[model samples]
Target: MQFIEFKKEHFIHDEKTGNYSLEIPKDEIGFGDVRLQKKQDDGSLAKIDAEIIDDLKQIKIILESPQDIRVNF
Candidate 1:
């Protein structure tokens, strides 16, 4: 298991909406072991929603939880 930092080339950033979309390789997910978290001011992680792409070998994550949050997975 590896923690990969998201890069610009990793996904599509919509200039109009100012949203980021990321795709994770399905192989990297062991038994669908994936999570979404939003960092809090108290240094805590809050779980968020993540969309899974069943047709493709990847998972799609949209960064739209909280503006002051540093979202991670």
Candidate 2:
């Protein structure tokens, strides 16, 4: 079996909230908020919490199981 994974990152600026919104991809399966920050002198991302919104579409896959297979002799 083989599967493909796709991801897209978008930055949303809201004047009312005064924060940046992270929009996840529509075809991916994971959605959540992640912290992002500028790199410090030690080259580590700062601890900044950012909201991640998800607008994903439905995904469907069909596979043939062993019980569904039939053989004719």
- Number of the top candidate by TM-score? 1
**Candidate 1, residues 1-73: lDDT per residue as tens digits?**
4344444455567678777777666666544455555555686667656454543576667664222232233
User: TM per model?
Assistant: 0.52, 0.32
For all candidates in order, the CA lDDT equals 0.53, 0.30
Which portions of model 2 miss their true places by more than 4 Å? 1-10, 29-41, 53-73
> Over all chains combined, what TM-score does candidate 2 have?
0.32
lDDT of 2 by residue, 1-73 (tens): 2223211223344567555443334344333332233334465444333332334542222111111111111
Compare the candidates by lDDT and give the number of the best one: 1
With a 3 Å backbone cut-off (N, CA, C), the pairs that clash in candidate 2 are: none
Local error of candidate 2 at residue 42 (angstroms)? 3.5
RMSD of every candidate to native, in Å, equals 4.7, 18.1
